[model samples]
Target: MTEWWLWMYVAAMAGGVVLFTRWRADPCGVPLSEYRVAIAIPLWSGFWYLVMALGGGRAEVAGHTLYWARYADWVVTSPLLLVALTLTATHSLPGRRWGLMSTLVGANVVVILGGLAAELTADATARYTLYAIGVLALLAVYGLIWGPLRAHAHRQPKEIAAVYREAALLLSVLWVGYPLFWLIGPAGAGLISSATTSLLFVLLSILTKVGWSIVDLGRLRSLSGRGRLTVV
Candidate 1:
C-alpha cells in the first residue's frame, strides 16, 4: 500500500467517527433510517483497529498485508450480518426482511470462508474475486429488499423520505466504493486510498444516518400527537 493513501484513509476513518458521534448525540433530530444503517460504523471500526493492531502501526506493515487483510472479511462481516438480519426480523418490515438478510449474510459468509481458503491455498485471484462478487451481490440484494421498507417509512412524510433516500444513496456509495478500492486501487489500497475512501464512507454513514434519525423522530412525534404511538 502506498504510504500517502494510507494516511488519507486514516483521516477519512477519523471523520466517520466524528459523524457517528454527532448522530448519536442528536438522535431526535436525525432520521430513523440511521439506527439500522449506522451498523457500518462498527464494521469499519473493527476493520481499522485490526489493520493497525495486526498490520504494524498505521503507517507500515512489516509482512504480507494480506494476512491481516484477510481477517477483515470475517471481522467486518460476522457482526454486521447479524445486525442486518436482526433488523429484518421485525414484524414492521413489509416483506421477508429475514430472507433477504439471510441471503446477504450467507453470501458474506461464503466469500469470507472462500477467501480464507484461497489465501491459505495460495490462490490470490480466487480469493479476491470471490470477495468482489460476494460484496456486489450483497449490495444488490440489500438495495432490493430494504428499499421497500425504507420507501414505506418515507411515505409518512417528506422529511422522512429525504432521510431514507439519503440513507439509500449512502449505502449505494459504500457498495460502489468498497469494491473499487479493493479491486482497482493498489494492494492494501486500504492503506493507499485510506483517507479518501474512509472519509467518504464515514461522511456518508453520518449524513445519511442523520437523515434516518430525523425521519424516525418525526414519525414518532407524529404518532404521539395522534395518540397512535401508544395504541399498541
Candidate 2:
C-alpha cells in the first residue's frame, strides 16, 4: 500500500512537470521565473518520490521508518513555493523584496530541519521539544505571510493582489496538515500505521505542489490576458 502511494505521488509530480512545461510555452507576459519555480517544485519532488518508490529513501531512525527524503524534498521545494508566492506580492517592491524572501525562507528551513530532527530523536522530551520549535517556526512563517506579505500584496493591482491572497491562503491551509499528520503518525506516536501516513503525505504533496501551482499559474495567465499582470 505504501509503495502504491509512492508511485501515485511520482505520477502526480510527473503530471505537474508536464503541465508546467506546456504552460511555459506562452507565459502571456507573466515572468518566466514563476514558471521555473513551479516546474522545479514538481520535478525535484518526482525524482525523490521515484527514489522512495524504489525503496531507496528510508532509514530506521529511533525505531521508526523515516522517509528522510521527504524532508530533503521539502527543504528545497517548500522554499521555492514560498519564493513563488513571495514574488507575486513583492515583485513591485524590489528594494526590500529579497530581504523579506530570505527571512521567510530561512524560517521555513528551520521548520523542516526541526521536524527532521524530531523524527530522528528517540527521547520523548527531546522529540517534542524539536516539534515545538518547528511549530514555532511555522507560526513565524504565518506571521510573515499574513502580516508583511499580505500588506505588500494588497498594494499591488487588485488582480495581482487577489492572486497572491488565493495562493497564500491555499498554502497556509495545506501546510497545517503536515505537522498534524506528523504528530499522530508513526513518527511521533504509534497511533497510525506507516502506510496510512504515506497515503496522507501523498495526498497533501499533490495538493500543495501540483494543485497549488496550477491555480497560481492559471490565475496569472488570466491576469496577463487582461493586461493586469506584467513580467517583473
Candidate 3:
C-alpha cells in the first residue's frame, strides 16, 4: 500500500509536468519565469517520488522508517513554490520584494530542516523542540504570505490580485495539513500507521504542488485571454 502511494505520487507529478508543459506553450503575457518555476516544482518532486518508488531515499531513524527524500524534495521545491507564489503577488521584483522573498525562502528552509531533524532524533524532548522550531518557522512563513505578500497583491490590477489571492489561499490552506499529518504520523506521536501517512502525504503533495499550480497558471491564462495580464 505504501509502495502504491509512492507510485501514485510519481504518476501525479508526471501528469503535472505534462499539464504545465501544455500551459507553457501558450504565449500569454504571463512571465516566462512563472512557467519555469511552475514546471520545476513538479519536475523535481516527480524525480524524488520516482526515487522513493524505486526503494531509494529511506532510512531507519529512531526505530521509525523515514523517507528522508521527501524532506530533500521539500527543501528545494518549497522554496521554488514560494518563489512562484511571491512572483505572482509582486509582479515586478523590487529591492524590498527581494528581501521579503529571501526571508520567506529562508524560513521555509528552516521549517523543512527542523522537521527532518525532529524525525531523526530519538529523544522525545529534543524531537518536540525541533518540531516547535519548525512550527515557529512555519508561522513566519504564514505571516509573510498573508501580510506583506497579500498586501502587495492587492496593489496589482484586480484580475492579477484575484489570481494571487486564490493561489495564496490555496497554498496556505493546503500547507497546514503537512504539520498536522507529521504530528499524528510516525514522525511524532505515531497515532497513525505509516501506510496511512504515506497515502495522506501523497494526496497532500498532489494538491499543494500540482493542484495549486493549475489554479495559478490557469487563472493567469484566463487573464491573458482577456488582455488583463501584461508582461512586466
Each prediction's TM-score against the native? 0.50, 0.96, 0.96
lDDT of 3 at 131: 98
lDDT (0 to 1) per candidate: 0.45, 0.90, 0.89
- Give a tens-digit lDDT track for model 1, residues 100-182: 55665665565455444433433456656666665665565566536654645444445434434544454444445545544
Q: Mark the regions of model 1 whose C-alpha exceeds 4 Å error after superposition.
A: 1-26, 29-64, 67-70, 73-99, 111-121, 124-136, 139-158, 185-232
Residue pair clashes in candidate 2: none
Tens-place lDDT per residue, model 2, 179-231, is: 99999999887799988898899999999999999998899899878877756
Which of the two candidates, 1 or 3, achieves a greater lDDT against the reference? 3
- Answer with 1 or 3, whichever has the higher TM-score: 3
In candidate 2, stretches whose alpha carbon ends up further than 4 angstroms from where it belongs are 92-96
lDDT of 1 at 46: 39
Model 2 worst lDDT window (10 residues):
90-99
